[model samples]
Target: MNPPVFKPRLSTSYLIVDDHALVREGIVRVVTNTWPHAHLSHAASLHEANKLLAEPGASFDTVVLDLNLGDSDGIQTLKTLRAAAPMARVAVVSANNDLDLALACLHEGACAFIPKMGSIDHFVRGLQTLASGGTYFPRDLLAQAQQREGAPTGVQPVAAISLTPRQHEVLHLLLQGLTNTLIAQELGISAETVKLHVSAILRSYGVANRVQLLLVCAGQDDSTAPQTH
Candidate 1:
């Protein structure tokens, strides 16, 4: 007589790596609470995360990883994940008390940054968006970062990063906070084309969102960002 092996099924799997169980449990509960049908998994350290991901057929649709994982911390965690799962969507789950680290995570490869310290409603919305294939940057932090970085109001200031001619024009319009449709209307181009340029802009300046991209480029003394066709 032979025994049969049972196979596991996963509609979609999620991974989380953090040192704290409370944080991990909270997120696990939240995720399962929202996505009742999804298969959930976790790791307490970067090493454990690596081991899990290395196993064959071990796949995760979205990884809500903590940047400050015990031994593996900061932007390094992001870089490692990017190298490990180049195709997987990643969101940096972090404490909201710091903006600099969050921004740094964005500069890396994280498609979005989620602040863990917030109303459950807020965290839920962010998780939902991440699961739904969209970036989830904290709205309040994005605004604050934009305002602070928008101005070069600091001592020993250096010239902000510059842009190319095309980038210059696109970046300026970005400063206006116009949507792709509006930008196309103003530039007399297809909205789809405007999206292409915005994608390039995000890549060029190493920014995660348009607000940060434009804020960084707006400080430059450039007159080249063309307006209207």
Candidate 2:
């Protein structure tokens, strides 16, 4: 039998705050897929987000925030938003995958901590968990953090990097040595979009090309060398 489809909660609303247009667009696309009818809003900075949230009858079920906003400190921004909208859940989407920062956000009332390079599965799972009034941290990250503090180990843990659902799909195909054109056809996205995702994935993995990226993902550490196009 096929897996059940994910139905976003009825009338669920979201606020996405990020400085980069492409990153914002990626998040928007992911959220739109899961919550096709959700009331989605965007802001580029803390000031802009505050202004929108201040409007009368302006409310959101969740706010997806970027930790490194241009004009605000990360935790301070979380505190400010929490003060202004005490009932809304906050999810921090950031490039900083530091475990301490993730823990700090949780302490300050964030419902989820999603790294920008995390796979689409983790992102969607985080959203689903938060929408149901629960907390979320990437399982691998959480496990590593726990291990550092003397928790017993389970399976060997892999480091986490963020990737949107579509990007994850592209990366999986790319690992199989597929070209952008082939990946585009496989995923039903434009080749241009596949290129964008590949570049973003490269940046996230700190590699210069597909070969190095595949190497890094295979538990190797060759990314420290100079990149080649």
lDDT of each: 0.65, 0.67
lDDT string for model 2 (74-121, tens) is: 789888887766656677887888877876776566656788776877
Candidate 2: Cα lDDT at 167:
62
The alpha-carbon RMSD values of the candidates against the true structure, listed in the order shown, are 14.7, 16.9
In model 1, what is the error at residue 35, expressed in angstroms? 1.9
lDDT of 1 by residue, 31-63 (tens): 787678878888998889889889999887667
Candidate 2 TM-score, true structure as reference: 0.57
lDDT of 2: 0.67
Candidate 2 regions exceeding 4 Å error are 1-11, 118-121, 128-134, 147-229
Off by over 4 Å in 1: 1-11, 148-229
Q: Candidate 2's error at 162, in angstroms?
A: 34
